[model samples]
Target: MTFFAEIFEGLRISWAAIRANRMRSVLTTLGVIIGVLTVTMMATAINGLNSTFQTSISIMGADVVYVQRFGWFMDRNEWLRSRNRREITMEQVRGVERQLTTAQAISPVAMTRKDLVYQRRNGGAVQIIGTTEKQVETGGLNMSQGRFFAAAEVEGARPVCVIGDDVATRMFPNESPLGRRLQVGDRTLEVVGVVEKRGRFLGMFSLDEVVFLPVTFFFNAYEQRPDLRIDVKVGSLAGIEETREELIGIMRKLRKTPPGAPDDFAINQQEAFVQNFNKVGGTIAALGLFVTGLSLFVGGIGIMNIMFVSVSERTKEIGIRRAIGAKRRTILLQFLIESVLLCVMGGIIALLLSAPITLVVALFLPAALSPSIILIALGVSITTGVISGFVPAYRASQMSPVDALRTE
Candidate 1:
């Protein structure tokens, strides 16, 4: 109770001091405000981006791997070597299904961009994917309406199609998209199913801006010899490493590669993407740390300098208080509370400024002022205040009453 009372009294005196020197207090708080703002916006942007990236990649299926012509992140030398490798044909995809023991599902995938049409409406430049019914397993797909086309339909070169949320909404607003004949590129395809909304990819490209069709029909409509991507889903995530090795051996055998030569095919997976993203994230974290440290150092020095000035200006006041039998702890608490109040004010102002900026970022990502970051900002402000104010407060507390009184 005694400690609380002292703190309350200190706060009352601190508020009075601030009110008496309003302009000085405001200018002193400016440095803290800039520092807090830098700390907050950097944390919030990274948090939002991290969250968005994780959600986007969740649907990439950790248990799945892609056998593609090239790696996603490749150097010039690797790209040159992989460029002339033989394309993965659909027959190889079928052969893998027959021979592989670890794979749960295997799909031969191909893609192209085309304009979509339904009645008078046009959805410009949408991604169209060609794959087998096994894509439902290889890709993380949840059908919101109707059903995926039958295996027989896929083998028979049927013109049935599955549309994503964006396509279903834009092309058939007032009616069910099922059984609706939609024109993709120049060929007409009936919409047999609609995919559930799966948000954007990396908070940039819309995953919903895609349509899936049977590879047989796709080849008929688009290119006769389109490059293929073989998607393989293992029975479990633990089995993926062995599954990749099996795929390499199968491809090498099919191509009849000479002994001791490097494998020509690339087996890409979600982990490769995650590894690359981590490197980029590390760079961003380093940069943010550097800027935050510099700002806090400059800001802390300004607070310390201003606090020393405050102690010098009030030497006579300190002398009078000491002569009247005020304790050293009370004097120290008074200065410390004053320093803390200024920083709290700056933190509040930075939060107000950050709200609109966070909202603007939310337009492009899943960003908001999470509760954790708010606590962090306020906690940083309080810590900075204590460190910056300690020396000035201790000097004021240790002042010799006679010397302080004689000065002014």
Candidate 2:
């Protein structure tokens, strides 16, 4: 009960001191405010990256594996070897469909960039994807308008197209896009469906700036012998490794290479993207935390320096308190409380500033001032106060009452 009373009195005295030296306290708190901002922002960015990556990967279909001629990332020698291999053909895709047991859906995909025109408005360098109705499933598309182009449409080599939401809004802002004709280079096609809006990938590249059309239409219009990638969607995530192994054997046999030589085709899975993202994102987060931690360190040092000055100026007060029978621990608690108050004040101000800053940051990057960040920032501020004020508080407590009184 005595200890609790002492702590209450300590808070009272400390708060009074801070209020009395309002200007000094405010200036001292600036460092802590800056430190809190950096830490909060860094944590927010790291969190945003994780969520954004998951969202983006889902749009690309996490369950689907890509079988392509070239790997997504490879060494120079690997690239050359892959370049020398025959392109994965529509025929091979059919073979994979026929033989593969693990795959639930298979989509033969090819892409090219073309400028799209709706009346006078031209969309610059829009990506065009050529795939079948299976693309609706394998690509994780949700139809916001109309429906996926039917299998009969693909079979009949219809020049119908499915537009992304962004394109739909941009091209036909005033009216429905369904049944409207859009020009894809020299070719004219009718929009049969509009895919739901998927924002950007990593808040950078737009995912909704693409058009999907039949594979035959793509081949006849773009490349005669198009380089194709087969998207193989699996049933179970737990069996992904087995799926990859099954794909490798099927590809090796399909390619008809001997058992000793390396397989010509690259079978890419979501795990590759996941593993690489984790490695890179972890390094970036570590570096970000380290850099932000320095600001806190500097703020702590500034608080320590100011606390020493505060203790020097209050030596006579300490002397009087000791003469009145104040314990050393009481003196220690008082200054420590004052330091913590200053830091907590800074943390509150920092949080206030973070609201607008977070809004602005969200415009360019996906960021949020989550509840966890708020708690962490305040906890850091309190901890910094304790660590910074300890040495100065100990010095003040160890002062001789007689010696302190003699200075005045």
Q: Please list the C-alpha lDDT of all candidates, in the order they appear.
A: 0.87, 0.89
lDDT of 2 at 107: 89
Q: Please provide TM-scores, in order, for all candidate models, with all chains considered together.
A: 0.94, 0.94
Local error of candidate 1 at residue 3 (angstroms): 3.0
**What range of 10 consecutive residues in model 1 has the weakest lDDT sum?**
88-97
- Residue 388 miss distance in model 1 (angstroms): 1.9
Compared to the true structure, candidate 2 yields what TM-score? 0.94
Candidate 2 lDDT score at position 2:
86
For model 1, residues 1-408, the per-residue Cα lDDT tens digits are 978988998899888888898998888888888888888888887888788778877877788899987888999998887789888777777778788888999988999999998888887879999999998988889999999887998989899999999989988999999999999999999999999999888888888989999999888889887889999989688999999999999887876777799887789998998888889888987899799878877877788888899899898988888888778998898899888888888888888888898899788667779888889889888888888988999999999989887778
Residue pairs clashing, model 2: none
Q: Which sections of candidate 1 miss by over 4 Å? A: 324-329
Judge candidate 2 at residue 260 and give its lDDT: 92
**Residue 145 displacement (Å), model 1:** 1.3
